[model samples]
Target chain A: DAGVTQSPTHLIKTRGQHVTLRCSPISGHKSVSWYQQVLGQGPQFIFQYYEKEERGRGNFPDRFSARQFPNYSSELNVNALLLGDSALYLCASSSLFRDRVTGNEQFFGPGTRLTVL
Target chain B: ELKVEQNPLFLSMQEGKNYTIYCNYSTTSDRLYWYRQDPGKSLESLFVLLSNGAVKQEGRLMASLDTKARLSTLHITAAVHDLSATYFCAVDTPLVFGKGTRLSVIA
Candidate 1:
């Protein structure tokens, strides 16, 4: 009954370096989504994976990518990180894939705060 | 493309007072959600509004959605300091979020 969880609570990277953030969804959850939240702004969706398949993607640059494992865990990778990428990366899990009626409410993880220095 | 807009980017409320936050979206969507985030913290799901005229309430917070107007509102009744945080309303599944409304409650 543990909620969604993410690793490396804090990370500091250089402008050109790459970073990988991991997320473990709640048990029985098959959908995972990634989001980037800038300070003082709402989170922006990055990628969504359902049943270990790419379900949807946001308007983020090609530098941002993500994948889901068979166990419903997920990883978000950012390549050639820019100063603009310095934000909190969040992972959310939902029980259902598409139906909004129920179990589609995404519960979020603690998030990985990435700082590009 | 869906665009979400939230009003009063920042709000300062006195305890025991009442106020409302509004979210307006550009496109039609059946699903709308409200989330709360404290500083340096992740989002906490507050409400999931799925249909037109859907209203859900929890304690001092209430959320309602009007799909026809592409708008949703979060109302705070008798605000308390414990409720201070930034609130965001997102649209659709992929969730196009609006600029959040930061609420600060003062005693």
Candidate 2:
């Protein structure tokens, strides 16, 4: 079984441009979450989608948004990107039931490195 | 608001030595997790501690959680160079994470 996968391994955008990162969850996984990891810092949760609905959101601003598809794939979009938004965007997936029973030991992708020039 | 704090933000140790990383969180949560990440790579799940006294071990790494004290510890036993990376502990609710502990196991 393939693990979670992300696309566009690297991206460079301008300060006012928009970028979208994509993620495909592992087979049979129903929950997907987005995180932003700054250099030298742990990942910060951005959004979590379960069963195609927004289940949780983090401290990120309105510029960040995400949506999950029926196949459990997800897309994270950042609008009007700022220099502060330059970071690695990570996508994680987990089985909702298993996550609830156990802790959320989410499987993560290699992440999309976004750089705002 | 859940806040997670990790101690020894940077750790440097020789091979065959032992060290411990600590994670303290504010607020009550039943789920805690530890993850490892190599430079420029994504996170790899290490341990998922769900109970008050949950302990899990794999290879030379061990993780234990104490919900009462809202603390979790990752212990490295006889560390090896292969174990060099950043380790993070996270709380499940809203999925808050610590600053991470960067461990360098020198050989």
Candidate 3:
């Protein structure tokens, strides 16, 4: 079985511009989460979607938004980007919503490297 | 405001040496996970520790979690060059991750 998939492996955008990153979860996976990883730092959760509904949101600002499609694919949209926005956008998928045992071990994609110039 | 902290942000060791990476979180969480990432690559799931004193092992790597102390440890035994990678520990609440420990095993 294939793992999580992301599109636009790399992108370069100027400040104040908008960017959209895509992700396709593994087959039969229902939960998708987005994270931003700055250089030399760990990933920070941005948003999570389950069954086309917003399940959880992180400390990101209003400029960031996301939606999950019926097929469980997700898109993270960032508007009015800043130089600090230059980082890797990662997408992770899990089979269960609330894991009673292990809390759904997330499988991550290769991630989209976004550079705000 | 969950925060995950990892000790020894960078580790360089010779092959066949044993080492342990520690992960401590600020908040309480029943679920903890360990992941590995290569340069320019995504994270790969390694282990998930659910309860206190939970332990899991694979190959040369083993992970243990102590929920009461809010700590997790990843132990590498007889490390090999192929085991070189950045290891991250994550918690369930808010999905917070540690800064990660970059392991470089020299042959």
Where does candidate 3 clash, by residue pair?
A: none
lDDT of 2: 0.91
Interface RMSD of 1: 1.2
Candidate 3 runs further than 4 Å off: none
**Predicted complex 2: DockQ:** 0.75
**Model 1 chain A lowest lDDT segment of ten:** A96-105
lDDT of model 2 at residue A33? 91
lDDT of 3 by residue, B1-107 (tens): 78899998999999999999999999888999898999989999999889899999999999999999999999999999999999999998457899999999998
Ordering by TM-score: 1, 3, 2
Q: Score the docking of each candidate (DockQ).
A: 0.77, 0.75, 0.81
Question: Order of all candidates by DockQ, from best down to worst?
Answer: 3, 1, 2
**Residue B25 in model 3: shift from native, Å?**
1.1
Q: A102 in model 1: Cα distance from truth in Å? A: 1.1
TM-score of each: 0.97, 0.97, 0.97
lDDT of 2 by residue, A1-117 (tens): 999999999999999999999999999999999999999899998999999999988888999999999898999999999999999999999888345675656889999999999
lDDT of 3 by residue, A1-98 (tens): 99999999999999999999999999999999999999888999999999999999998899999999999999999999999999999999998789
